[model samples]
Target: MPLILPDQLIDQEVLNQENIFTMSQDQADHQDIRPIKILIVNLMPKKEETELQLLRMLSNSALQMNIDLVRMDSYQATHASQDRLKKFYKTYDQIKDQNFDAMIITGAPVERMDYQDIIYWKELKHIFDFAREHVFSTLFICWSAQAALYHYFGVPKQEVEEKIFGIYQYEKKKEDPILKGFDDSFYAPQSRYTYVKEEDLREIPQIQVLSSREDTGVGLATTLDHRFVFSFGHWEYDKETLHEEYLRDLDKGLATQIPKNYYRQDDPQGDIIMNWRSSGSLFFSNWLNYCVYQETPYQLEKIKGVKVAKFGGSSLASASQFSKVKKIIQAKEDREIIVVSAPGKRSKDDQKVTDLLEKYYEGKKRARDLEVMIESFRKDQAAKRQEAQEALAAVRTRFQEIVRDLDLEEALKEDLDETFQDLDKTQSKDFVLSRGEYLNAKILARALDYDFIDAKDIIRLKSQDQLDYGESYKAIIKTIHKGQRVVVPGFYGANAQGDIRTFKRGGSDYTGSIIASALQSKVYENWTDVSGIMTQDPNLSKDAKRIPSMNYQELTDLIDQGAQVYQRDAIDLVKEKNITLKILNTNAPEEGGTEIKDQEDK
Candidate 1:
């Protein structure tokens, strides 16, 4: 039950004074047991304080643990001693190859800033990616939880009008291993400027909300498999953490509110209420026993894999659908690379954007009408933030540029005769058709706050009808960074002469497959409107049932027989790579969708 830590950790003296049992590496080596390896990616400015708080909570567990501390090497620490960090902590690069039973990423004070603007954001993404493949389970605390939610699922944190700084009561919402103790309601400390909505979390099928409150929103949540745990409240905070935060804020001349329910009679000088300690200890103990110790493989090296998710047109049709796409992407950490199709029909009577573009290209629709449709789509995708508005304007300008040389004699087409002379009609048509996906990817990237990668930049085409796989693989490797969530437009790529060429309609599925095969992803997830492949078309057969799973050969046979659930070429690509394919419903994700895999692998 002793914690194995560095011999001279800066906080060791404080922990010793508190009578927490700790052992040096030399002493732990002499022991016969294989101590659980725990990595702590400490992000709090007060390094020593955070270490003591986390070490105290972890010390309550009966299982012995070897705690390895890590710091972000990309950013220099101003509050903590550089000498101490160099001596007691390791950087991400130093331990990138090592596996751990569990890892804890502490909260930082960068919640208000955009994720990309943070100096160490790139480095932290690598750490997050490493944990997904190497660490058995990861616990994200406060701001880290928000960051992880955004990075993985595209769930953005909304800033509240006031900071939630106090002890709040959260009621148990669901029964799970992470919340094993008996408690209908419990007190936990909350000190944050932002919070994630329970409604948003509920949309993600993979996440299970464990505890929540009317006032505090979501307090605790975890993935259904317990691989990732998110704690919005700081259960590891010391009794005076809030008090110190209040004083610090006041000293800086900022308006500060008294921490609610933390003192007798709401007086700062009154006796402090320490009701959360018992629940906090029980929570950490349960996490160790149930979430980590019982589930992790004895050999840590056995843990490794990644998933590529592709959202179809129907799944990313409207603003609401776009939100669903973000949640699905964020639900699993391994779903790092996202591929998106153009907006589809929002309702039975609605028209897909791609169809509208095609009609305009064929001269069946007016150019003015097409422009109006595109503008409406742009407004629907805007998020009411400055960045989204800016993206909206940029997307509108790009659309205008693409249609500038159109043969239509409208106010939109000026100097059409001169422009037509220079325009290659074939290339212009391909560019116009691809804008549906291009604009959607731009909007989606802004909404999710992820990098936007144009498919033409990486996916290479040998000709209008032929794909260049070798060149595409090399280009994808060169352009995309490992572990970064990026949004890529599907259906179109560039040829050897740098001319834009498009695959046949419904070719986004093929785009996803190529990326999955190029990345060697363990699984390729295709999200559509239906739960899975049905035995018969639901529109025709009232008793149509969903197929839980099928083999690659069976799927190929179905395609050969004219089943239209997936693209035939996409199926061939994934089959050749031996990548497992999952057919998921973006709307009704809880239903176990169909899975396609090689028979031998299954």
Candidate 2:
């Protein structure tokens, strides 16, 4: 069974219990195209349970995924049936020669035992060594994460006083591509007897900590490049997984407590609250997208050695800037993907597209030159409605003029009217905010004779307005035709209800970074007003000089210090992918601008 499994044993149960569907019918139609080849090495003792859990977690994306189950060559498990292993699992030697887009190494039950004393330690080491060359990316979970960290980075794990078994709250240490759609705080299930110290990870320059909790130590960690991810939490666990573990321990007369923040009100007999399920889904999906799908070469052999460059656009505010961008693209054969922001102010007196939209939203809520404020929840008044209509009409006029100036034909009137009416019905501020990028992108696409793609159709956001990394990547790759010059609107995506939503301020750059990461562009060129990133604000100090280059860490420090070089979200999207980011000036395209590279690259 591959991407579109017709009747998996766990499909119905998972679908009913967790709502994890592999792909839509539309996505299944694209199966004539090659599917991502993924290999899962099941090291857990309860092979069948782990199989169902992992498969369910991997099933939500639109990517056509084919999975191969693997087992250690040196050891036989008495827990899993030998017949099942023979029928379904492939030994390491059988698949070691083949290449995989991604490989997942599951947690083993032997954490207290010494690494050298483990029965399959030698075989596991061999597989790990093979994965470096044979796999594009690898996800190491729980005990496996610990083992790999020890083997690769020489990081040691220390024994804890007691087994850490509960649903714990973890906060993101910093943003990473692997956390594309994660909230500020999330819940994850931890069941372990030993933990890797935060200090140990700090000593390793290559390893980056992702999620950590005060009570539980490090929850997730990854390498600088993110080709390898070490996850301490059981992100693929089902709702009752921890409960089942606790029950098993209690049955053996071993001391165990009820999982914390798990069962509703901490009563074991009460309903189990599934807080960690969404976080788990997001984690797996992100690893698949940013680490595997985006990094893996289309031609499997090409993965042995590969390089990438990415480029993007600025706030194409005026016809002058638009022409400059077009010239820049024509100058280079490699400029394939374009990220377009909303038009900015053409002059001092002119209003930015986003500002105009925000003004319209304000007008929609209140009548001009009146003491009374019009509320959306109340019945519409004629005078207030007239004010709102005039505001929308003004915005439409600007779009029409821009389209006309660009000498492009578009159904701006019809689409604007429809979208405006939809917004009135829904009263969604994001839908209003999105029109800035939407209109500009359409105009730019027509002007350049490129395909106009709505970010909503590709960039996916959850109900919580967080990005769905894997699904977003799949949507982009599947929807965007290969070798086509495509222009995507920045800042917005559709939520779970298919309603428009937007990112925070200066999100156009964030959108640009995401597009670059997904496309694996060679260099992400962020064209803006300034020459490049300056050492200090130009207005604050006339002596401020543009930095020629900086590493991701330096850039992060600068942003934290109130520098406005990029939106906070942009760096994380590109850093892990190793995509070079350049800050270039649209006015002076010929001048060499600031180049952001890896610390080693600089």
Candidate 3:
């Protein structure tokens, strides 16, 4: 069977020219069987070139596949226009909720910087989390493999004194499905500035080394489950990829080395060897058949669910807390609807984020305030900062005379003022107070690579304090599609006039309830500090025990008696919808917590 792709893929003509069989989406839709859905997170700079290389490898499989191309929303590609990206590619936000049979994340030209220093590092991490729960199998290539190692296993990549640029030989270390048809050794292209220590990966119990070379360390590795596949060398690279890189590096005045074992008789002007194409095709085929097509559910929606999870302030207090929350979400593929609250204190002495925002808002605002905020946001490593500053300085100096009359500072101020010109005193206060949740949701959304759906955009209210459920349901349905994971700030919604209005201090639980009700979710999870509803407050009684299960009436009675585990309104909403409500602990999810239902199970 031929590969199935979008109707207007820009590289379809190129693939056709190479004798690759491909069918359009419209043509595939008429078929009775479901095509394997594959998502390609293309991170390479030359979008069209990388598309052709990857598509050629994917076409080797007998199973038909529908390809969805995704691009980084944070990084703008100078090589491709915005129109091309809009038409041909999707952002992580657009498909995070959707499940995939397999995913391919390509390498980028950012091996020099520290992983955290990359502009889209947080966003990429989100995609990594998504792959864990949403994708059946994911192939990470080159720099992306190094990134996956660091993100998933805490294995770091060390900067090599010289770039490993060549077509190198790799020996198979294991008899695995991925290397089922491979020989004792195979050749692939390697162009990288950093390498991961083989010893570090071997120490992790979950990871297995499939192939390696003495000079290149670990060329291929996978998790014990085989859900994640990593390749240090580029098997999908064309015969001329390295040649183009070499020439481009030379043009930039960098000391570049000729690719080894690539050109005929080692001559720069000679014909390319092109020895890796067969192996690349076989590898992709094995992955599709063994890792994805066989293991993924025939009905993709069978793996999906409308589960809502609400995380409180303490659960999102620090960066480490955010990482914990991401792992919790990854634990279950069905945990799709995520609700988040404002940041809490890092320590007993630290002020609450809401108070800090209120204080900042009540005080006089200055340009220096904006600088401080921007400085805090741009907390990249010193080396990266210096490099960026130097580059900016050079650009400014070059453009000094050409734009001598320009007032850069005034121009920046004007842009900032124009963005916030509509905020009045009341609206400004609401906006500032809401920033704690808005900013927290934004950070979490970037970290999870999921869509950040603002509550004001979907959570409609009839008046300042009353929710308009009818209108809100329609808005939520329109904003969120089937199979997408999204993050929404809690405790606030928009009134008829579109002014931001917040609920009581602990109203985030209510926000969670509304979303669960709107989506008609089967289970609404409230993640907090406590494991579940307790017979007694743990703070007051060291002997308090977690309630295993309770009926809706019992929960309401406890709420009437002043149990602060859930808001009364929130409980009522879920109760009316007959949705099971689970109270779980973010700190220790293994404890299992408590469950509330309309009636106790016999």
Candidate 4:
């Protein structure tokens, strides 16, 4: 989507050459769709360049975004002209009354100094505090991430031994929705003198580490709910950004280390690898799609107290099923958290998305050349790779068509394209296996007008293969809140090792139960094909009727006796919490299916 820039101020010819859409005020006034309002508090010295860079990043998404540029009233900017600032920018005071869909606080070149020592620190603190109430989501980049961490959490930043200048590979600490479609590891450029330690972040329970490198420490951290995304590295940097900085430092005779893993053979004159661009694009697009566009309330004022309803993919497999789910959600104002699985089997011979993924995985065989056993032979593996690519392409195309048919945000279609590309770079069996649910969750979120949170991020498991209920529940509680409808994908959770793990068959039910129990929800509605559990095996006895009510004991016995309704583990998770498990049919939700409860409840 296009960024709403001032037609007179922005060079239309330049934007056109770059393919960036800019609308005049007169043009914007007539549009029926309300553009997402984004506020950028540009702190970088080169304000215009930063403006262009940030706009380019925001432009990749399929949201009609309106940009409001702001400059600090208390501080003077030396790099940008006063006339330019006065013409295009507004001070925080001027726009304080208005609420924004999202805001971006860029990095200032003052990280080495104490927070209080900066001239505009006081005003910046006010803006930071203002964001909690006025902005639906805020992104703190580089120094701002550190500043927010210190101001809100009392975390202190320490100067590093040397400038951490380089393109470094960071391990994704958790599977955040922000990092959805991201590989197991990705590279980001970092150039900083001061840093926030991951240990300090751990002290504050609300702060969750999203990504970190072995030596570089925490690269990204955010509040458990992801209302705020803090990026320590420069994911917005262009390919030659580091190289330009390196050259400038060398020209000035400043002490610096060569940016590690950046140049070919560590040679400054050699070709620079643009490794972070793909991940960067995906990161920004996800923030715009999941966090800003979907999470923020349309009326703006309703954002504070929205409820959550999580819908599984099986319940939303078709248009009719989606309509049923929508009706069910409309009946309750407080149900907004949605947990979606990938599309399920429509017929006996039809394939579930998850099943197709397993087949796709099979096509990616590691072929080796006997002559050179050290590495896989590209030529030998070409045919298999092509086969895998074709299978994966079908899955991607299927989801793309669904999203298009549903009239979702254009950014979502772009996301599908990027996700398939990211999937091609991964060799992890589990990562490839989980794309089914991830894509499904995105589609459902768009269809239901709810934000999608990846299960791999919030659902925690121990390194020993046991559920880490304490950490998992804490994270979920921090993330999901009242007045917000969110859909989390099911079937898998990540362990301490960052490996995706799944439950037995019908794990999506298990995932839903965990979310409900954790939140102490009023009821856990498990939507399925059948109305509810039948009196007997329906397949065996045609006379079997839908059971209107049952206790947990009876449900467990039926499941144990091969009645394929609810998983035993799923029942056990929510049974103790007294959360009534309502099984409603997606196709016939109006029929009002069975409600399973404790024996005393009857």
Q: Say which candidate scores most in lDDT.
A: 1
Q: Compose the digit string of candidate 4's lDDT tens values, residues 404-476.
A: 6677748586878777887777766677777877888777677777877888778998853477877888778
Sliding window of 10 residues with minimal summed lDDT for model 4: 365-374
Q: What would the per-residue lDDT of candidate 3 be over residues 309-368, giving only the tens digit for each residue?
A: 999988887666777898999888888889998877667776566666555444423322
The 10-residue segment with the lowest total lDDT in model 2: 305-314
Q: Estimate the overall C-alpha local distance difference test score of candidate 3.
A: 0.79
Model 2 Cα lDDT, one tens digit per residue, 123-143: 897777666667888999999
Model 1 vs. true fold: TM: 0.56
Q: Tell me how many clashing residue pairs each candidate has.
A: 2, 10, 6, 23
TM-score of each: 0.56, 0.49, 0.55, 0.53
Candidate 2 TM-score over all chains jointly: 0.49
- Go through the candidates in order and give each one's C-alpha lDDT: 0.81, 0.77, 0.79, 0.79
Q: Clashing pairs in model 2?
A: 308-522, 309-521, 309-522, 309-523, 310-521, 310-522, 310-523, 310-524, 311-523, 311-525
**Runs in model 4 with CA error above 4 Å?**
305-480, 484-602
Q: Which model, 1 or 2, shows the larger TM-score?
A: 1
Worst 10 residues of 1 by lDDT: 415-424
Candidate number that wins on TM-score, 1 or 3: 1
CA lDDT for candidate 2 = 0.77
In model 4, how large is the Cα lDDT of residue 144? 96
